[model samples]
Target: MSLLNGIFPKMKMTRSSNQSTIVSLADKEYKKDRPLVKMCGITSARDAAKAAEAGANFIGMIFWPDSKRSIPLPIAKEISRKRWFLAGGVNHMNVCEALSILRPHGIDVSSGICGPDGIQKDELQILSFMKAVHSVHY
Candidate 1:
């Protein structure tokens, strides 16, 4: 087996001790305070549906071919039917163009937010994008 495969024990349920079980329950209650948004790049539609059912506010569907999370627009459209936010590749230079087409509730961008390897947002670009969206009637 591959090193990654061996390390993860595919689809195996974690055996939680009593203390761990109590911690998990407590964590669930704590998470109720703020809506958590999860970006799933490695999950199938069924798994994404489960996340939606569990109260995820956003579900990302990668459209960048270079990413392992990349999925076709058709599949993304199909899986994005639930109430959760649907967002895909909003990092490319043509992101605004794509947004015009997909019309997702919100767009997510990381690399596009800054220079390569940078950790912060490019304030000017961010403001421009936000302003543009605000100008739109929808």
Candidate 2:
């Protein structure tokens, strides 16, 4: 089975160390909160829907073909109701223009947010990217 399918099983049973069982996502009830969250590297619509139902503020669909997590535009478009960001190769240089065109609720980045090593996440780079994103009205 695919990673997405495994992550979003129809019914999941979790047993705690105390031997208490936790209800599945389908059976659990929740009180909503206002924190905005985004699920990145989603490859399937089913997973996207599950993320939306679980209260994600945004879902990320990586469009860069080079990334293993990339999802096709058609599949990404199939997911609706929840705001989503297109990630992969997104950086400060093109973020504003991409935001203006895509108009997603937010954007996501992995490599673009990394430091000189191109792997480790850079706090300063992330902050700068956020500032750039916030500067755009839309």
Please name the candidate that would achieve the greatest lDDT relative to the true structure. 2
Q: What tens-digit string does per-residue lDDT give for candidate 2 at 1-138?
A: 342223222223344588643323332222233334667887775676566567664567777778888766566555432356678878877778766655665566788889999889999989988887888894
In model 1, what lDDT does residue 124 have?
74
Which stretches in model 2 have alpha-carbon errors above 4 Å?
1-38, 43-47, 50-58, 72-82, 120-124
Candidate 1 Cα RMSD (Å): 13.1
| Global fold similarity of model 1 (TM-score) | 0.57
Residue pairs in collision within model 1: none
Alpha carbon RMSD to native, model 2: 12.4
**Model 2 lDDT vs. the true structure?**
0.63
lDDT of 2 at 99: 68
Error of 1 at 110 (Å): 1.8
Distance from true location, Cα of 8 in model 2, Å: 21
- Candidate 2 lDDT at 136 equals 89
